[model samples]
Target chain A: MKKEKGKELVAGLFSLLPIILAISIFLLLLTKAFPLLSLKSLPTILFSSAWQPQKGQFGLWPFILGTIWVTITAFILAAPLSILTAIYISDYASGRLKKWLVPVIDLLAGLPSVIYGMWGILLIVPLVGKYLAPLFGTYSSGYCILTAGIVLAVMILPTIVNVSVEVLSAVPADLKEAALALGATRLEVVRFIVLKKSRPGVAAACVLGLSRAFGETLAVMMVVGNVPLTPTSLFSPAYPLPALLANNYGEMLSIPGYEAALNLAAVVLLFMVIIFSLAARLYLNKLEQRID
Target chain B: MGSRQKSTDRRLRRRHRAEAGFKLILLASIILVAIILSIILVTILWKSLPALKLSMILQTPGTGYYLGKKGGILNAIVGSLEVSLGATLIALVIALPTVIYLNTYLKRKSFLAEVIRLSLDVLWGIPSIVYGVFGFLLMLMLHLRASLLAGMITIALVELPILSRALDETIRLVPAELKEASYALGGNRWQTSTRVVLRQALPGLITSILIALGRGLGDGASVLFTAGYTDRITTSLFQPVATLPLAIFFQLNSPFPEVQERAFASAAILTLLILIISLLTRYFGRKLSRHKVR
Candidate 1:
């Protein structure tokens, strides 16, 4: 009984650590962000595009929109490709191919973001600058919204593919077998039955990917041009929220509200990411229960 | 009947055509992802081959290191090991207990367990940069300088969610019969958990730890502000440390070609280290399945 009591006390204390950490992090960011909030109304800070930290102007509209643009474009590029790859791996690929393919895809995720940034610098920037842009009768330095999106797409591909593959695998085998037995082709069975059943799971996978893309810093920073202006088009240079903090945090104390402004950015970034992730987690949980 | 039969054949041809088209697209997507992965690996290897001298791995940076004069990245390499390995150890101690308590002490499908899992998922989802900022603010609050200990603690937070989630799934797979057998012998929950649960979950436990270590080693943003960079290898917990990710980020942006080459060298070295860790986990996972009761 004594041993049990001690174990209970220790484990209980340890488990509460995460809870405490989460609460404290939120509170700390909030406290840091309070000065910005008190100085500017929420709408003025959120809707204004002015961001001269020296001038005490702290509008985050540009960065906020930049994050949205990059994340959305990345999903547009990644989602279809990832879903198709997942479908093929789950339904058609041979065992040996599946083994090889799964590991290779996962290796991309394990690669450091800096490496991806380097590749972006070496390949995508040049491709966009030299070829894709000029082909459209436009010129770009190639570090723009589209370039970041392409790189970010590659970064998030594994998350989507791995999760989608798992979700597809969870579809009851008998449903597919029954569809096959009824003279439906394999592809037809997948489209009509498996896809229909696992739609929510796939959506959850994309949501999970969105959460990752929203907060990616170094890779996007390296490629996204960091011009701090509202991106006017796909090829326009942009600055994202995480990149904002990364580039300015070192010298934030030079200005009056600079520290609070950056802290508010962190607050906003964390809030969006947490909402998306929590929703996906809860939805997946409910989906699992329903399917089971 | 002849017309109906003809239409049926037409529909069959269309279905087959659609299937073939999708098949082609799927194959193309898979090939594209594979090509991307290979391109990254090949490019890093090709660029780093010339700059990656034997001494680069063996010796610390000498005078004019950034000028491409002499010396290896011994300090950054060693510093990465200290921070990530230390973080992994710290994360493991905390995560193992939380996971055990969740699986053993809590009822299946309990609300508290669900809430904890949700919180972990959110924590994992939060970007590494936020953690960096948080770590920086935390250091400021405590009036501590950027140091190895601060970096380890920060990275430990980053690794905690990954470790706990990985462990939660693994521990849940332990056969219930083993627990019951222990209880039948009058083994307390404490004894049953430590002896049986820990043993059965050992392979997964180790794999998760290594995975967390890999993440910490590869991360640059969270440690960027917290770890702070230094040239010489210092053993003190309070001293600033260098890491491979920041090394790559800083060097690649330099105006000198030689320095950029060293960045690639660092990339190549870091890549090889992570690959080895993953390959080891795969091997151990296969070899250690013997420990499982089933």
Candidate 2:
């Protein structure tokens, strides 16, 4: 009996590890970043575009704006297509196509971000610089906000599609069949019953996709020409928070206040990711539990 | 009556046409996605074809390797494998017990389990860069340099949530009757978890681990700061290690066209590794029958 109690205690302690980790991560970043908050007002750091770290001006608005532009663009591009693909796979696709799609999407989702980054550099960058930008009456050097958005949209497609498909699949078939028997067209049945029922679930899927885009590092870093300025146009280069951290975290030791500034950026990114992901996770969890 | 019937027919025709049109659009989206996936694969293959040599895998980068001169990426390949494998081992050791504890010692849907699950989900969603920064700060406090060991521990943190959440899903599928039967046979919680639940969820456990391993192997940002890149392969725990993603990253940034071409080749190798892991996952996932005796 004593042995059993010990085993339980051991396992229980391990279970608390996740909570402990979460708190430590939050506290460590917040504390390291607290000095910067004290030194610089929150509004100035968040709103100013001036980012000369050496001159004691450490505005992060450009990076924050860049993250927003890229993520929103990716979200706009991915959300509808993900829903359409999910609908097709769960409803319209034939057996053969369905069989192929599950694995193909799995492959897309599994391919590393580095591969996507390479693809961004190799294909999207050139396409944007040479063709798309010019069509829009502008010239880009190929590394720009739009290119990053395109790459990110492709990268996050599988993540959204997989979840959306599951959400769509879980819609009770009986409801659809009943709607069909009432003389509803197939699309009407889907749009009215399936889509209606899965709205919140699909919204959660898109939110999770947004969180994913906001946090993506290497792929966005590669294509998003890391110039520290607010992105005025899609063809302009921009820097994002994750890229800022990845690019400057190691070399910032020589500059005073730079480490704290970077830590604050990480904290900002942490908040963004946690807020979006937690909302989606809780909503999805509730939906699943209700069903169960 | 004739006019009314004709109007109703027109409405039906429009609705049917609308249905057909909408379905076609949806079909087109799926087709576009497939084409893009194919294009990505083909592009990687085509770009790397010239640089894909057997020696590329067998040898390390030599002097002036970045100058488009001589050598391969064996250092990165080994380093990536070592870090990911190491992280996987550590995560599994910790995660399996946490999962067992959740499913057995705690009541289903207990408040503690709910909080644990929620926290892990949030951790899983936290960007890898935050983990990188966290690990870097920890290393600073300990006066440790960027190295393979630091990378492993950092990645292990990233993998922990992934492993636990995924394994949680798999273990949840184990029927309650099995546990009840184990207890009926005089098995305690430990015996049921080890002797029964472990046996039941092995395939799924492996599958979840593979998924986490794939994430760890392919991840670049979390280890970017914790494990600074190196051209030379070292078995020492304290020495900086190279990885496939960073190798591709650095090589692609090279001015030399030859070096740039090698970047594509590196991307292809990384993609191939992940592809194999995904395939293994599919195989094991299929083997993970939802109910053993239903």
Candidate 3:
């Protein structure tokens, strides 16, 4: 009885570790960020694009907008491709084909973002600068929002594809068979029955992709020119929140109020990511219910 | 009636063609993704050729290496291994116990378990750069210097969720009857958990640890400020240390061709390290799964 009781006590203490860590991280970010809130109004901090920190202007609009632009552009590129890939794998691919494809996708997902950054610099940037930008009539050095978005798309594609594949596979086989029995073609069954049934899971996949793309640092930071600007074109230079925080925090430590501003940026980034992930979870819950 | 039948036949033909075309397009996308991945690997390997000599791995980084000078990345490699290994160890201490608590001690639908799962999901989504900033704040508050120790602590926080979640899923997969059998044999909860559960979950636990290790090794943002960079390798936890990701980042930014070559070389080295770790994991997983009942 004593041993059992001791085991329970130990287990209880260890289980508190995650809760404590989560709460402490939240508190740390909040405490650091609250001071900046007192110093500046929320609207000013969020809306103005003028961010000359040396002259005391600490607006975050440019970074936030940059983040949104890059994330959206990546999503636009990745969603269709990943969804189609998932559909092919789940509904059409032969067993042998799938055996080869699944491992490749998994490896792509596991590849580090730093490696992606390297590839962007060596391949995508130059390709864009030399070939693609001319077709669009834009003069790009290639270290721009477009390059970052493309790399980010590739980095996050596997997440969407992996989730979508699992979701589509979980769809009841009877539903597709029923549609076929009603004189529906293969395409119709897939489009009208399977795709419709897996909509919630697909939405969750897209949101999860968005969350990951929004927070990616090393790859986007390396590809996107770290210039603080409101992006005017896909080829225009801009800085996202993660890049800005990473580039400036080392210097910001010595300056008054600067570190607080960086912390505030992190706070914003954290909240946005958390919100997206929660929404994804909510969709996943709905998907589970439908499956049941 | 003849005209209507003809129109329906035309529509069927067009729909069939469309299906074929869409399948081709989907196939093209998969091929495109594969092509891009291969091209990345090829380009890095090709560009790294100039600096891929044997001595690069053997010797420490030379002075002025960042200024387009020729040198090696040995220091950064050692530093990254030490920090990631240390962080993985720390994360294991917390993750293993928590996973056991969740699987063996609590009901599956318990409120605390749900909350932990939710919070872990949130933590998994939080960016590594945010972890870096948080670590910076921690160091400042404690009046401690940025060192290898700080980086390990920060990375442990970053990796804990991933490791715990992976192990939790594995534990959840353990059959109820097997666990019940242990209970029937008069095994206490701890004994059942450690002896039966851990034995069954060994392969998965190793995989999770390797995954966390791979993630920890590849990350640059979280360690950027916490582990201050150095040209020389040090084993002391209090001392600042260099890392491969930072080495690649700083080197690639320099305007010198030679320095840029070193950057590509370092990238290749990092990629090779990750590949080796993954291959080892695969081998280990296959070998160990023979003993795993499920």
Candidate 4:
């Protein structure tokens, strides 16, 4: 046992080296970059409304608002459709059909985000411009929050459906049988027993979906019109934090402290994602506990 | 009595139709997503039709659109292949050991494992643009200019979270009985891990690697600052390299139609590559799981 323990210790130390190195490098970079800008300046940089790089004024409020708007729009559009579809697939579809449909969802989820962005650029934006924008107003840019939100919804649908379906499918067979034996209809059983049991998982799925929507950069950047202003309407041009960083980093090289500010923005975004995913993990843990 | 029974049957038939309607809507959702994907594919092909001639694939990028003389995306394709493969290899080397450590020696340290898992999840959630900024700063600090080496290292960092989680999950999925049997034979922990658990998890690990490769190959923004675009292919890892996705991004904003068409063609190629890898990984993963069951 002692020899086995020694071998295990050696193997463990070896395995941890790479992860430790990667994390330390990231943290070291963060530390080096942080002192360039004062902590007192961070709030204005983050919360102030204006962002003119030429004037050396940078406020992240508009970008934050854009991110929140697009993500919320995506969730609102995707959540109901995803939940309804998950319910139908889990409770109503035949076993054979479910088997085939499940893989399609998986495939959609696995497709890289860049491809989705390309598709949005080549097809969806033009179609929206040609058809949908005419109804809104002549001044409306075709690639606006609506276009991005719709594409984001499509991108996040598979994730939501996959998780919700798994949760709904795991609703105890005995509960369903008991409901039916009590003379409750199939729809009633689904409405009450299955959904109630799977609520946490479904909620977790929605949070995960929101997380993806918020973090999505490539597709939204391609179609978001990327104006650095707070959007007053769905058709107004805007910029999210990710897009702002991506679009300006190359040209901002001559601007003093722009790089450090961008890094701070990134750090903030990373913190938000950490909080979101931690909430999701906690929800999933609670669901698992309930299941046990 | 006969009339009452007939009414009951009709009511049952109507209820069944409503259930069928719900199913139809669900199926329609799937079809809708598929149609959108197909439309994107068709649009790319349509846009790139002018550049679909054989020479476009074989020739190099040069000045002037010489109709049939316009060179192919040879350099961009080769560069993508090199950088993506290089990054995947690096990520695998890093991820494999981390996964093994988490699954075995650190298994008892649930708190630490949870923290690691949470960090990885957050890492995956962080936007690619953030990675670009981080990479640029790190490279500047290290005195490494914008080069393939910087880009590859950045991509490897971005991919580590997913790859590690995949490896960890697959390692955990290895049957406890297998490890116990190895231990009974007087095999050490390293022996059990490398010989038994790793062998069992190889297929899943390969799937994870392929997924990471697909992500790296399709990445654009993260490498934009780290690896500036270069048309001429170079052998040195410390030089600029043009990749397919970056080519697409650059071409989209270009004034030239030919360049834009080439971008579409490149995007088409990337989309198909990712789709193919995704399908193959899913197939192999299923096969491996089935093998385990037997």
Tens digit of lDDT per residue, candidate 4, span B113-143? 6666655665666667777877887788899
TM-score of every model versus the real structure: 0.98, 0.98, 0.95, 0.90
> Would you list the rank order by lDDT, best first?
2, 1, 3, 4
Give the per-residue lDDT of model 3 (tens digit) for A3-66.
Answer: 9879877877887888877788889988887877887898998898999777667899999999
- Candidate 1's error at A212, in angstroms? 0.1
Clashing pairs in 4: B56-B72
> Where does model 2 exceed 4 Å of error?
B290-292
Candidate 3, position B277, lDDT: 74
* lDDT measured at residue B77 in model 1 versus the true structure, 0 to 100: 97
Looking at model 3, residue A193 earns an lDDT score of 84
Of 1 and 4, the candidate ahead on lDDT is: 1
Chain A TM-score for predicted structure 3: 0.95
Best by lDDT: 2
lDDT of 1 at A123: 88
Clashes of 2: 0
DockQ per candidate: 0.78, 0.85, 0.66, 0.45
Model 3 chain B: ten consecutive residues of lowest lDDT: B285-294
Q: Which stretches of candidate 4 lie over 4 Å from their true place?
A: A1-11, A14-40, A181-183, A285-292, B1-21, B65-69
How far is A26's C-alpha from truth in model 2 (Å)? Answer: 0.6
Whole-model lDDT, candidate 3?
A: 0.86
Ranking by DockQ: 2, 1, 3, 4
Model 2: per-residue Cα lDDT over A23-44, one tens digit each: 8999999999988888889898
